[model samples]
Target: MQQLLAVAIRDILPNKVRLAITRLCFFFNAICSKVLDPVKFDDLENEAVIILCQLEMYFPPAFFDIMVHLIVHLVREIKCCGPVYLRWMYPVERYMKILKGYTKNLHRPEASIVERYIAEEAVEFCSEYIKKAKPVGLPESRHDDRVGGKGSRGLHVITPSVEDLLQAHLYVLNNSNEVLPYIVQHQHLVKQSNPKMSKNWVLKNHNKTFSDWFKDKIFADENVSETLRKLAHGPKRNVITWQGYDINKYSFYTKPMLTVNSKHIR
Candidate 1:
């Protein structure tokens, strides 16, 4: 709840108030996350006290209940025992609720629970030998394929416009680390030729002409890396577009999918 609220709150709240909320959420989230280290928990425990003080300044006195105080002790309790989910009462409460449902007769509730439980146990035991039986599990989601950035999908080839192709090819070169030296060298040449040019003017000149300049440079030099040589030649005008591309464990959709409500992307 705090995590979700923090994002929306940042847009609306004053700077100090937003910082308070963001820090509070981080402290709570860090405490509950799976791995526990005493050293980190100790730091979080200290931060918890500061967060409560921040909350106290913003919230009314009535808000400081025993429940709120328990936030500080959470880290200590986890250190003494294990993770909260392993020891919480929620699981026990759920089982008790299930047992209550087996009581069809109010007058003989205990007998009903015992009889139902034994029958359930017997059925489970017998079902183990049934070869055709399938274990019930979570159903497959339709968006499963759209979940990663492994590669491009739904490839459609098109001859892109010259201006768009040049811009895209320039963007690729600008971002690629291997091409950084060539970029710096080209920028130096642009600056040297136009000695009085402003930095922005030099950048504009570089972006406009660097593709051809780099291609010529690559052709003249024989010692350059193959990667740089391929980049110098530039991407084909006939490029492949994707409806979906999976990268960094996320599926991204092209703009056309957004307009038509893509089934693979939510």
Candidate 2:
């Protein structure tokens, strides 16, 4: 399939679209091998068609518009047995990530719409899981002037609720299915590293209350969020850091993904 796309892309006029065509072919090839059958091919084909149509819109004179529409229709011909076959395990998110990378690389005129659409779709997908899971009740505001700071009112310092935990869990699960196994294997490290810090530390040591700890430890940590974002993109290798932290490089779970690298490539 990749070879076929590589050849077809060569014929696409406008060097930028041609390059995008080539990369997208490779991206699809990587994803198609993993998706559940039947629905997988059709959805992937449809996605490819959408991208091609975007390209055609940019370069209509190349007759790529007809090719784009034909490809879109071909997607309907592929038959699948189950709905799961249509649903992507991680490919949808990964595809959007790749599109972002591709658009950045190409610097094309019409790529922003495609990039924005893909990113928005990814967020929508994440929101679905958020809706399904309960929110983790992390502290939002502090109360004491000494601990909470100037003019704060909220009384109790709340910790991340179950929803926040679940959101983090599902985000990791859907994005890097492989990381689960690794996380499971090293759950000990995660438990130690992510020990539920006491509110006292935030109040006395940091001059803030438990509420501050909740917000700072869970929600306000930019590094942790960035790490989650990376994990959401793809399966990453669990690189053991020198700091004696043997946690899953991507997720903070006890189990790791089942053949994380292979599952990702497939």
Candidate 3:
């Protein structure tokens, strides 16, 4: 069963980073399930293996939860785009909420450890990751009461403290990264094309305030109510990445995003 699972994983994982994550997940699950039959999931390079092992020690099951949270978004999209019956087979939204709450709580301790590691090591891994990452445009910018001006294209840098970073990750688990992939990977087409309006689109669309949107659209689930409350009351500009793979926003400096130059990136 484990061998078959490994084979399937190799087929699905599209890159080195995803492969590293797969191997780490495989290791964690194998250790927990006591699968000791000489599995060959350790085909990762030396550096990748070391990083995965470090992540395992630094995060344990918490890292797995974070990875699961990111993957859930993709899985949800797949279901949404599939047949109606297939959509019912996966409780994507409800599972996402559960994973969000779980991942947020998991990182509480790790953020503290990350904070300490960054301070002691004097490495700005978080900043480095952010610098390397191509910025994504905000989706459907609306006028902000706080700024009292029309929003323009720019990076939304939300700086958070160590504890706040942990909380942010939890909050973001529910908010999928719809803009990043579109903007970063396919910039020309998006810029040239005027996107067709959806059949369900509305101009004034019974406009809901932030609180209104939170209550009606977002906050029906009671499982994450406490966390949501914290988020509602807390700051948003800079926080830890709970759900998304964008590591730049995370509080830790040691676990930066692995970047290669566009020329070198394969």
For model 2, state the Cα shift of residue 236 in Å. 59
Task: Tally clashes: model 3.
Answer: 5
Q: What's the lDDT for candidate 3? A: 0.43
TM-score for candidate 2, residues paired by index: 0.22
Model 1 lDDT per residue over 1-266, tens place: 76797888977888877887899888767766777677787788889889889888887899889999998898888888887666779789999999999999899999999999999999988877773555579465345546434446677888979998899999999999988888999999999999998999999999999999989989899999899989989888787667777665566876545556644543
Error of 2 at 223 (Å): 70
Cα lDDT for residue 116, model 2? Answer: 66
lDDT of 3 by residue, 103-147 (tens): 434548567555655564565766676765655894532332233
TM-score of each model, paired residue for residue: 0.46, 0.22, 0.15
Better of 2 and 3 by lDDT: 2
Residue pairs with colliding backbones in model 1 are 148-246, 149-246, 149-247, 150-246
User: Candidates sorted by TM-score, descending order?
Assistant: 1, 2, 3
What ranges in model 2 sit over 4 Å off? 1-15, 27-36, 39-42, 65-67, 80-266
Q: What is the alpha-carbon RMSD of candidate 1 to the true structure? A: 9.2
lDDT value, residue 191 of candidate 3:
31
